[model samples]
Target: MQLTVFFDPKFLAIMSNRLQNKKSHKILFLDNTLDVGGQEKLLYDFLSRIDRGRFDAVICCLKRGGYLKDAFKKLGFGFYEELLSHKYDALAYRKVSRILAKEKVDLIHSFIHPNTVFFSHMAMLTRSVKAWVLAIHASGSPAGGRLIGRFQKLFLSRVSRYVALADAHKRYLVDVEGLPEKKIDVINNGVDVDKFHPGPSDPDFKKGLGISEGEQVVTTVASLNRRKRIDLLLQSASIVLEKRRHVRFLIVGGGPERNRLEHLTRYFGIEKNVTFTGIRDDTPAILRASDLFVLASMRGTETFPLVLLEAMASGLPVVSTDVGSVRELVVDGESAIVVPPENAEALAQAIEILLTNEEKARVFGMKGREVAVERFTLDQMSIRMERLYEHVLSRSRRAD
Candidate 1:
């Protein structure tokens, strides 16, 4: 068991140990929680698919372990749930130190903010580890656009290496966070295309939601939050109804903003056309049942959303704001329409184009699916990460 501090790329040390070259190294990943966000999905998917023969993995989540944690365990992976007492728990430090010693962790991967600081602090003091790797989720930065930027930048600089979600993230690491280019890797968030691809709606989706056969349904599956801009969704849906009557909206997630968003729908007089299904596990089927998929988010927070890839894999053309790395995946006309965030008129018009032209929509959906299958597959992400782990472990041994 080797416990270490923040990662060092150029590390080469003299040591006294009989280290084998091919033994599977153990890794510990500390994620803030197991919520159903795109970043959480990326972390969980990596935990599930990484090569077990080359690496032994254990995940210790701070709190709120979702169904995916159990799903990981079902696949024979080890997990430690709800170890943190609270968001700023002092006891968490001691508890994590014990787990590190007991598990004999070789490397620590920190996902989200503060966890990097906490883990790096522990590892530096303990002097028993090899490296600390930080996974930078886009939302962890200052999409809110104010004092949060200062905090985000401070937190980013404390890590060993930054694993970015997209190329935009890597750029921010270099320009904003001042991290070296070699210290950042832009590993785009990937989905399990086989699982997220088009599926027959559970035979009950329409029945449960009272969606009739001839209704034009559009679904957006994201946390009900300010960044998601559910109000913009409702505003656009109102515009969509002017061109085509009887268009229905299906919102398939819940959060703090659900009540406000619901009120906004009524305020816009399109309450009758919208249905808030709350948080749901049947995302692929819900997306499959939709005539179109939309994601209306501001730029900084929504870099490479997993739902966009899922929508593409489900053969649905997307209409999203040109935010973050969205332009990297969604071509203006080829894959999906890219609109400016908060522009109700543009959003509505883009969605209407896809809805009105079935032939073009089908072509875009097919092209998006091809991109998802070829570039954003879970297997490809796992393979890249497996090689990363092998490299990390090999370097760790050489440093000894």
Candidate 2:
């Protein structure tokens, strides 16, 4: 018997080259707008902290200018804007396809609706891109009503991977959209703990908001939309004030519903107690000045709210509605006080409980901070995403 050992020379050479020259993977991110929202903020955070040696990032938005445009440019990443005037623009789609091919993007990660639908199809059209990842940040039907919702379900099947902001979102994708459960992955939004840690309250911030020295400030940072239920929050503020008149409410965000919400404050006769600080840039400072955080969102609108994490990281106890995986984010009695949505009385009661017990509130804040640092940090999220990219790339290569 003759012992023969044979190895393919081409295979050996390819392996040697791969080890010697590790090529950095190029990733492209697509979004409808770079507005100052949770999804956009998370994208900025991921790109800013992602490992530069292993991956390069590029961003393209459907709408041209947004608050985060300058921030992305400061990160030394290329940014492109392809404005889509209509719902279905064939020219815009072609332009995006060309961009993906020209950039040699290995992976295309798209967030939210039309971006997810558009880029996934574009990846198929380009043929050069290895994978397309779709991320769903909100847990509800697609925007633009039912027809667009149907289109989303139809297009979502074409993407190579799906990421949900929370498990509740994953279930929605499966049950409502008929997506396979195995195709979806749940990755909660994370915050930069170091940037949002507990610290001395900013006196200037409080002064600007007209918060008195003895008044306890309750702050909420969210877009002022009907879905956010700012009306209910106003009612809750009125309820809280009836018992404790020294508390103040700070509503920080700008949207079409601002006028209505402001009117509701007047209607409830809590105008003196409620301050509408429309769209401030210094969120961490505002959160630090706050003694408590509340989010009274409507049911089924939220997935995993980033503001809650920011508040937790800021060492403030939260009182949020039990909507879309919020219970998963906060332990009812331990980290936050979870209450039912659309119930102003319940919301006010939860706020009063925290306000009455200073020691218990302090303990909850400390525990929340610990949870945020351990479970939801920028570094941890980046590492998980890096691994996910590598896994997708490996699978694509094997298929090739």
Q: Alpha carbon lDDT of residue 71, candidate 1?
A: 64
Tens digit of per-residue lDDT, candidate 1, span 157-208 = 4345667777876786677656689877777777788887865575477768
Candidate that scores best on lDDT = 2
Error of 1 at 184 (Å): 0.7
**lDDT computed for candidate 1:** 0.76
Score candidate 2 by TM-score against the native. Answer: 0.91
* lDDT agreement with native, every candidate: 0.76, 0.83
Tens digit per residue, CA lDDT, model 2, 231-296: 999999999999999999999998999988888888989999999999887899999999999999
Residue clash pairs of candidate 1: 2-128, 2-129, 3-128, 3-129, 4-129
Report lDDT (Cα) of residue 383, candidate 1.
Answer: 81
